[model samples]
Target: MSRIGVVTFPGSLDDRDALRAIRLSGAEPVALWHDDADLHGVDAVVLPGGFSYGDYLRCGAIARFSPAMLSIVDAANAGLPVLGICNGFQILCEAHLLPGALTRNEHLHFRNRDQWLRVEQTDTAWTSAYQPGEEILIPVKNGEGCYVADPATLEMLETTGRVVFRYLRGNPNGSQHDIAGVRNAAGNVVGLMPHPEHAVEALTGPSTDGLGIFTAVLAHLGTAVPAASRDRR
Candidate 1:
């Protein structure tokens, strides 16, 4: 089985949820400690959302120097599939794995709600299961969810199709161009400000659309179940 590593930082609140979501997607979920320097031979990794290191000194500033992030940074740069959610997304930017930075929401409040997202690009390892132009519903909660980038970088991303997800309906955080997620140049590393793991089950979420992301990565790694076994909603 393709084992996916989920890093748990000191103040992480959604690591367990990510683990469960990975298991539900038919992959083995490995728990990785933030203080550990090893990756445990996992095929891919997930930087789950949370208030890492109590979100002090900026949301992900403190957590970026954790030991686990060292290996993650190295692996992600080498083309390993890496998904960063919410605060994790912030850390990715802080660590320079992705472009842009997440700042305080335009409203200056911690917004928590089911957010609608449009799949702007599906060429990434994490978004391959979704068709281009598909819409999904996922939960988003954060005080700093607004994404900002320099004009040059923003234009490059736009020209390269690196924008993976975009907010639908009304903009939730006043992110530039409604960008909800973005990917590295290689398209294996992705960072987003929404909680996809939280929306994998209909009973606890508004929809199971987020499951596509997990399954997409598995498929990209050649470990996903046969097409016949895939539950196409």
Candidate 2:
């Protein structure tokens, strides 16, 4: 089975949820420490969300220098699949792996609620199972969820089709263009604000729309191409 590494920082609250999601998607979940400095031969990594380093200075600024992050950055650049959720998204920005920084909610308060997201682009390692324009509902919670980037970066992101997810109903946290998620230029690294792990089971009461992310990651690792018959290659 593909081994998925979930990084546990000092304040990560969603590490276990990420592990369960990986298992549900038929992958072996590996718990990696924040200071390990190694990926433990895992096929992929998931930076689960929470108040890393107590969200000091900035959401992920302090955690960016964690020893384990160095390994993750190297592997991610070499095409290892990486997914950053919420504060993980912030870390991606802080580490310069992906563009944009998450800022305080426009409402100026920590907000938590089920969010509606539109799949803006599906040609990514973590969203291949979704069709362009697919809409999903996942829970989002955070104080700084708004995504901001310079004009040039924003234009480049838009032109490259790197924007993966967007807010649908409410622009919860005021993410730019209602942007809920984005990917690196190479598509190997992705970051999103919503917590997909929290929505994987229907017993929790909401639709299981978030499961597509984990399924999509598995699809990325597998040799199977999505909609294989539609491929002309």
Candidate 3:
């Protein structure tokens, strides 16, 4: 089975949920510590949401220098699939793996609710299971979820289809361009302000639509490598 690694920093609150979501998607979940530099050969990695390092000095600024992130940054740059949710999104920005920064919500409040998102780009590794324009409901909770980029970078994202997900019904946290998520130029690294892992099970969450991300990564990896190589991983 494909092994997906979930990194746990000092204050990560959703690592277990991400692990469960990975298992539900028919993949193995590997627990990777924030202080570990090794990736354990996992096929993909997920930086789950939480108040990492107590959210001091900014949501993810402190956690950006975690040992695990060093490997994650290198792996993601080499085309390994990486997904960042909420605070993880903040971390990705701080690490410079993706463009823009997730600032405090426009309303200056910690917004937490079931959020509706539109799949704007299905070409990314984390969004391939979704159809273009498809809508999904997932939970979002954060104080800094507003995504902002310079004009040039925003235009690049719009033109290159790097904007993977957008807020649908209402703009929660006032993200620019209503962007809920975005992917790297290579489409292997994606960061979102919503908590998809929290919505993977209908019994526990608002919906199961979030399962698409985990499944999409598996599909992306399957097609990217030779069948034999995939089997070995």
Best by TM-score: 1
Per-residue CA lDDT of candidate 3, range 3-62, in tens? 999999999999999999888777889999999999999999999999999999998898
Runs of candidate 2 exceeding 4 Å displacement = 223-233
**Model 1 off-target regions past 4 Å?**
226-229
Native-to-model Cα distance after best TM-score fit, residue 148 in candidate 3, in Å: 0.8
Instruction: State the lDDT at 222 in candidate 2.
Output: 85
User: Residue 205 in candidate 2 has what lDDT?
Assistant: 26
Q: What residue pairs clash in candidate 1, if any at all?
A: none
For all predicted structures, in order, the TM-scores are 0.97, 0.94, 0.94
lDDT of 1 by residue, 147-218 (tens): 999999999999999999999987888899999999999999999999999988878877888888899999
Model 1 RMSD in Å is: 1.2
Candidate that would win on lDDT: 1
Give residue 130's error in model 2 in angstroms: 0.7
Tens digit of per-residue lDDT, candidate 2, span 79-189: 999999999999999999999899999889888899889999898889887789988888999889999988898899988899999988889888888889999988989
* Model 3 ranges off by over 4 Å: 223-233
